[model samples]
Target: MQQKGGAAPSLFRNGFLQTILLSNVLLQIGIWVRNFAILLYVSETTAKDPYAISLISVAEFAPIFVFSFIGGTFADRWRPKRTMVWCDLLSAVSVFAVLLTIHFGSWHFVYLVTFISAILSQFSQPSGMRLFKRHVPEEQLQQGMALFQSMMAIFMVLGPMLGTFVYSTFGLETSIAVMGVVFLLSALVLVRLPKDEQEPRTEEGKGQFRREFVEGFRYVWHSPVLRMLGAAFILAGLAVGVAQALGLFVVTERLGKTEEFLQYMLMVNGAAMLIGGGIVAVFAKRVAPQILLAIGMVVGAVCTILVGYSTSVPVTLVVQFVNGLVFPCIHIGISTMILQWSHASIVGRVNGVLNPMFVGMMVVSMSLAGPLKDAFSLVSIYVGSGLLFLFGALMMIPIMGHKAPEKAQAAAPAPAAVRTEP
Candidate 1:
């Protein structure tokens, strides 16, 4: 399926691509439902303390911060499908365990379950990325990635509403148990994929798993493109994280909100993401890779700033629409470029390295936003987030000089001294 001369694969024939798109839809749907409800569950079940609620969010991501780099490296080393299946199975098991613990135990057990789920899920990202490249032709990467992201957006738009309904009627334990089943469903679909779709990378160590895992970190650190992207990932994530954390407060306080109207705005933003993703899938192949990276960051950053600048909810909604529009391009484009840029062996390590960069940004923003909201205006937080986006744009500069592997080799100049004079 690999295309020469930098051509990407056409999307129609990629079975793995189709399988992932379908599986991710279900996986994300379950995730969206769980994500929205988990915090509320933590607060209600755990005596309603705000700090404990904060921990709910932090606990889910805390392990990702610690394990992401290793996850990425391991992703490269292992068969993506195998790794992915195991992750999903473990996630399902963890959730089921929580249900059992909750039957016998305290509400705090729910929080612990959420944390374990987060750790299991981190491995799936790198695994999926590696798997995609195997069955996908290089030319269709943009469309393929777009299709993947669009599914997540589709689920996000619906997941919260569904979660609310399910939780209200079914109660928390039943809803969570269902979410656990969703992971098993994903695992079932994943099992259908070919085992060999995992791209082979040079294994660094002949000895123990720990040593091999550590080598994954070293491999990623050595690659300049990955190193730079790691930094950019952190910065871009911070801006987005701040905006996400402050969303409800900003909507209710500064801009008066009708509940129905807020829902409409969310719909608009989610639709924009789907639309943007589709557009990127079709048109991105013709664009320069570097330009795609820069444009996505620049537009995403600008939309963020505008979302805060105006007081009108409608205007803010428009900005969010624009933000959604710009976001997929950045996500899909950067992902496409980064995956293309790295070699197979180190894919896991590269992703693992990326873990800290993004997790650091998000952890800082979510933890600090509440205190900062107390100290400074939410508008200032928004504005500060915008400035962070500008920093993300600056990070895109290093994306410019990347040449395809063959092209780089082809472009190397022959020595003049080696040729005899005529």
Candidate 2:
């Protein structure tokens, strides 16, 4: 796993090169804006709780649990570029439809739009990732992954500010319209992806999509390594959601800040994500995925413990930054390992299983976060999450280990082990 440590390798050139970068940027912009619009519209227009926001966290991501297997199969069978293009086009059209509904003063459309976006997003993401694997070379996979993570980091870091500005300067509808345009732009960029060998077109490809979805899940059920990886991700997502759901509460109560401090807390943590992105790009492959996963869980655990005790914004920021750097390494490693273990044809199915496995856990985690916070304490949440991460790290010890004759374990190096999904 060791390689040159200081810089990422060269991996892209030409118009096709610009295409990947630009498309990633556009996709992030569209995602951020669309999510922002939903949150804002909920806070302002909805009167169910007077200041009611639909408690749709569960509904939002839980669909991936249901749809990932189908989407994954499709991603594997179809021409990836065309698949991604259609997904983006669907996104653009869907966003535009929401905008029209809003313009016509129909708040009722929000629920339908939200569900549509959720389902369509699963199709777009796995197909888009398939393009990354097809175009990027094996030797440069680490750098490619790092750069991809960084691209997401930039969008994540900048998205909220830009979305807010658009909404404020123009209007909410203007922001929604901008998201549609970005989706269209992303689709165009995807159109340039170099064609690769098509997947096997068998009767299996035409089988019941639902059955295909179950088949992917069955793959995970059968593989011990994949099962452990899934458990690690499930708990990891839940751990983060617990903390994320309570971030504002942490600062205001512990640091004695008012509600206004929420913005600063969010901004600073977002900035830390940029730091995490850089670390992942520089070290994703240089460090063994297993080793990184171990360190990530350990560091993240320590940060969480520190965060639980921190009494001020500065202390919280430092702990938060530490958590940020490690979390991405863990995430990128899991994703890279999955891609490495998969044949290109089955990559989509693998990703589809992961989409729900990861996202769906967050839904369960968020649902319980409120009850947990009320019953125990925020510090308990942090400590519990940290403990779960430690458990997750320990779980990885067997996964990355090679399955060979017992005699080989003595002769071969004891590879660094961590919880892995691939």
Candidate 3:
């Protein structure tokens, strides 16, 4: 593991990093605006029906389950710059199509737009990961991941607020147009990325999508660290999924709070994540990633349990904040581990395989959360989830005792391999 001094490291010295961050910030803003606008549009247009609102979530998430692995496969083969740019361009076009559909007097196209954007995002995300792996130095990978996540944390807090403001003040059409324009701008900015420096593909690599896809799975299965990581993520997802599924009920029925209070709690958590991401970015290199991850999981598990048992609103909010703060530790640890352990050749596919384990499991856990709450109680669900988190934390202990696999060490590229043009 690489350690830096206490002062903040200068990751921004690289022009490529600056360009990607600027474009990503703009793209995130547009996405958040579009997301909130569509959400509000669905709520208002459907008379606040729960089913209609749920459809938006389904539309947004289903593609991840269906296409993430495929996206990862293609991400490995394709130039990251071109793939990301085209995905953003296509997303912009999709948003414009949604605008056109609305103008033609049909509201149903909103879900289609959401679904299409999500599908494009599946492609863009893996390619972005590949780019990050290629450009960031090994020593600063954790910090890079933390900084990226911090950006996401900032957006999570502000995006919805901005989206709501834009929708309410300017109206849906204008909001959608703004979203399209931002995406287009993001694409244009991406054109500034230095050309990809990937190894040339062999003739055998030209047309073997199925074989390549299967190989990704095989690689993950062969890697002990990745195998365990997948398992941990699945359990973490279950824990989180149950909490999310029942959070509103816990607020209303248990804490005697309104929806507004729930919103505040979420906002507070988002703000905490922003703080936590900065902390990790500065200090992550000092600690072993596995140890940090274990600590994060254990703390997060305890917080989850406390949130279940705590009756006071203030107490729960504090717990939620702590939860937010610690959760990023696990995320940063895992992301850095991926960068460290996996060869660049397969990192995209590794991400593709690993992402679904967490997301798909979350979906499954969510499906079970309702019935579990109805049959048992909300507290019971929380306890179960906390226990699941504990299990994941415990699983990390064995890995903590060992050094990274020899193959992993051997596979790591030199810093120059990832350094980009000034």
Candidate 4:
């Protein structure tokens, strides 16, 4: 869909958006069911063995680190629509395979359901980004990202409930079956996406995979905007990781509430996210992504400090709500900026290179947060996290006036996408 004159294309009318959003909804249903069902089943079957429980988490997350770049490289080389469809189909096939294995007294094999899907998603997610870059008008990128994030926010509030209800009411076998079915449906929904444009072939195929992967890094390093964003990603990851690790402490030690109260805080945050997403989507065209990102980080810094320092329940909750509200800005702005700054052909690789920066640093900081907590006061840790947020905001300053660069020619290398000015 193309923009007419200066008017943005109708997002709801766009076939890509319609299909992808519906596919994502089905995907979310399957994912949450798989997540909660597996967790509960593993807990009961293993008698809540700590190692077994930890292994479940490892199965879900480890693949992101291992296969992200590899998957991204393939996504760039492959047709995005086909890649996404195959990933979902494979995920469904794996889930059903796990279900069958469970029936034969091999219940421990259930971890493969999470592991395989997680690995496939590394391939699938980047392909979706590639499709997004190819299909979405640059003017509507932020709005589209906001809308997508808002749907995820809705899931954050409802997903656990839905998963728990299904597992509790229907048992493990049925939950697994449901997950398989949902994934199948998501694959079907994706069939409605517009056909992928055929690229002209030359005697030489898309460059060597290894060479392209290395170029992804070089691409980010050379772009002043992307370079700053990478640094921001690291700082933001560190800040978020520490805050996430210590959030329970804020609920208990600071607010003098039990651990269960954390759910209520999450609920408030989720509700605020829905509202924030709406606000951002409405005003998307008015603000540049860098400014939006910087503002979000600054607000996050203030809220982080307040949440740590507040002793009153209402005050802490309010700060938590505000934090939830602006959280979408951070995500939407980042996604929009990446799409705007990178060439369409290299979107997958750029996402692959950047996502790991955030997730890897977050994981490292999360591990360190425990040790830091042992040595420092909770308030002090919160203040430090806030400082990290401030630093992340400062990283945006260099790119504040930048606009989306002109789309590079399909044959251009990654670095050719870089534009020195707005």
Candidate 5:
């Protein structure tokens, strides 16, 4: 399981890895372009109506809640490469359908398109996770995941700007067409990936869909480390919910800043994430995943508290940037742990179960955040979020003392099972 001679493998040198990364970059760009274009289009058409904007968020969230687990079950049962390619092709078709609706002046169909695409993405995500688990070497798993995360970080910074520019220059119809093309390109590139070697199914896994779904839940519930991780994820979701609900008010009402300043704060944080991802890609192997999680949580809690207390724009920006910097560490640590601990056969369902826990909690937290904000001062909400983060960090402490199971280590899939480009 160790690296060959303990030297880091060159990720770019692996043709399969290169194909995945390139395809992912294009896919991400298309997603961001579509997201921002739709948001801007909605805002302008609806006169900045809050309800309309909320509908877009709901469209994105509801699919994850409803279809993620189902998607995971299918991903496990299906071929990973085929699942991913078909998902991409379906997404492109959805975009084209949206374009046709737009041509017919049925703008309401846009929401339906978004929902369908989100549903397809649920399938694609777990398929991608399964691919990473099968293909990436055990010792270099963290590095591979970190590099993938860094691409996301870069896209977060660039996507919105690019979306806005394209929308402004070409209008909605043209922008939608571009998104369709980008998705098709992503599918074509994914076709270059070799077919996955299918593993034999066990008797326990052969059954009704309901049983398979419940099995995923049971597996995670039985694993002590996974149980703790799920608790931390819920708490982290609550913290995020609090921040999302009250962040604007804290900036404008409490600190007397403008929307422009808020945008600057976001850009700074995005840039910090890009830099932090680079650090993780280079040094993630040297640190234990549990230790990395603890450090990220502690640092995030402190910075979040500082952000609440600071009145000066410069001070708030600095703390927010630092918060973003450590954020990737938390993600990389958790993802690597999931890949290492879960059996390849059920990894898709495991991811599906875990993702909804975080998102569902965020939905619950968002519901509560509004009432809590109306009752207490915004600073109070921020401080409460910091406490929640601290609680999550405390939950990680026990994990630091524990070790991965020897059986899990022995069960790790061989690299030969993962086919790369010849």
Candidate 6:
């Protein structure tokens, strides 16, 4: 139900909210253990061969670009609660399959664990979003998103440590076993979510993948908000890719510090993200999403330039900290905007369409960052990324002050519905 300038509902009181949050915690534990254990194992086996290590990343991320839309399409067709549960169960099964493969001495097949789990997540994550739409009250959506992102930020701080400790203390076999167990536990937790509403099956729904896929694109294209969001996603993706690719250089060249200092920077950022999520939650109702997103992008742009230009370690760290503080604004704003703008039936497809645009650009920019670095100064590249962020913020201006449509308006025909203003 929509709130009209009243207090929001108690988010924790919702059964779906409680269940999904618990499920996410378990998923994070599994994911981190999987990430670091596989990394350490690959490092040891390949004798730290950079190419071999890079393949792990390829296995993990390649599916998001290749299978995100496909997974999303299926997510729309399937029951969300069942889809999430099955994804986790299948992930657990895949992890154990890889564990057996490892035991049999075909250790290289370990990459299969990461690839399969990653692909399943493409399906699972969108379903989670669908569930969010189903269960979360409109009034509490931002706060709910904040709580969700804060949980992730906590993992950002602790996940690496937990993963490394599990791998180091228990060894590869136990680590993989732990990953399987946590995934199973996550699946169990998701069973507590509200049952999916049953929709009547129609013959028309059976063989319309190609048409539905096209409709997703047309849906986004017809919406002014989504079109601008897609543009912003492209810019943010490029900016983030540049930062991810050259972040080590900020420690090494800009601050003249060793690579170990990078960890401290990450910790600082993660901690700030936790606090930022809280603050955004408190103020979520007071500010519009477009404004929140624009504010974050503007801060991000400034911090990127500052971090790039700062020679002092303290200056760089402060910039990172501040950048982290506003990062959730970007995420929460984007997510809430999508939920508010899109209808429930097409939420998965919308996510699938938008996700690839971001991931695809990030991959492209990461690939380009190397050549760009060779051609230009690091500071200049950073400034260019900062400009990209600014452009992303600019894309939000037209949609500023926009609010979600009423339920009646939302239920109207797609073209007429999306084009309606608050």
User: Highest TM-score among the candidates is held by which one?
Assistant: 6
Question: What residue pairs are clashing in model 3?
Answer: none
The TM-scores, one per candidate, come to 0.87, 0.87, 0.93, 0.94, 0.93, 0.95
- The sequence of per-residue lDDT tens digits that candidate 3 reaches over residues 1-422 is 12234543468776667888899899888888889999999999999999999899899889998999999888877788899999999999989988998989788888887799889988898888777776766667788888887998999889879999999999889988998999999999999887877566556556677877887787788777778888898999898888898888878988998876888888989999999999998897788788878888899889988888888998999998998898789889888877777777677788999998988889889889878987997777788889998999887876776555434345443222222222
Please write out the lDDT profile of model 4 over residues 177-215, one tens digit for every residue: 998998999999998888877654333444567777887
> On a 0 to 1 TM-score scale, where does candidate 3 land against the true structure?
0.93
lDDT scores for all predictions? 0.71, 0.69, 0.83, 0.86, 0.81, 0.87
Candidate 5 lDDT:
0.81
- Across 1-422, the per-residue lDDT of candidate 1 in tens digits comes to 35555545457666777788777877776776677677667656667788887777777778887778667756655667888889889989998998898888876677766788788777788888766655666666667777877876776588778887877787778878887999999889887787664222233343245765666555456656556667677887788778877777767776777544666767889988888877877887787555676677777777776766667877888888888887787778667765666554455555676667777888787777788889987767777887777777677677576664532112222112111122
> What lDDT score goes with residue 314 in model 3?
88
Cα lDDT of candidate 1 equals 0.71
lDDT of 3: 0.83
Per-residue lDDT tens digits for candidate 6, residues 349-409, read: 7899998888888888988998999999999999999999999999999988566775423
Which run of 10 residues does model 2 get worst, by summed lDDT?
413-422
lDDT of 5 at 238: 87
Candidate 5's residue-wise lDDT over 90-136, tens digit each? 99998998889888977877687678889999999898888887767
Better model by TM-score, 4 or 6? 6
Backbone clashes in model 6, listed as residue pairs: none
For model 3 the local lDDT of residue 176 reads 88
Off by over 4 Å in 6: 1-8, 201-203, 408-422
- Could you give me the TM-score of model 6 versus the true structure? 0.95
Model 3 lDDT at residue 379 = 77
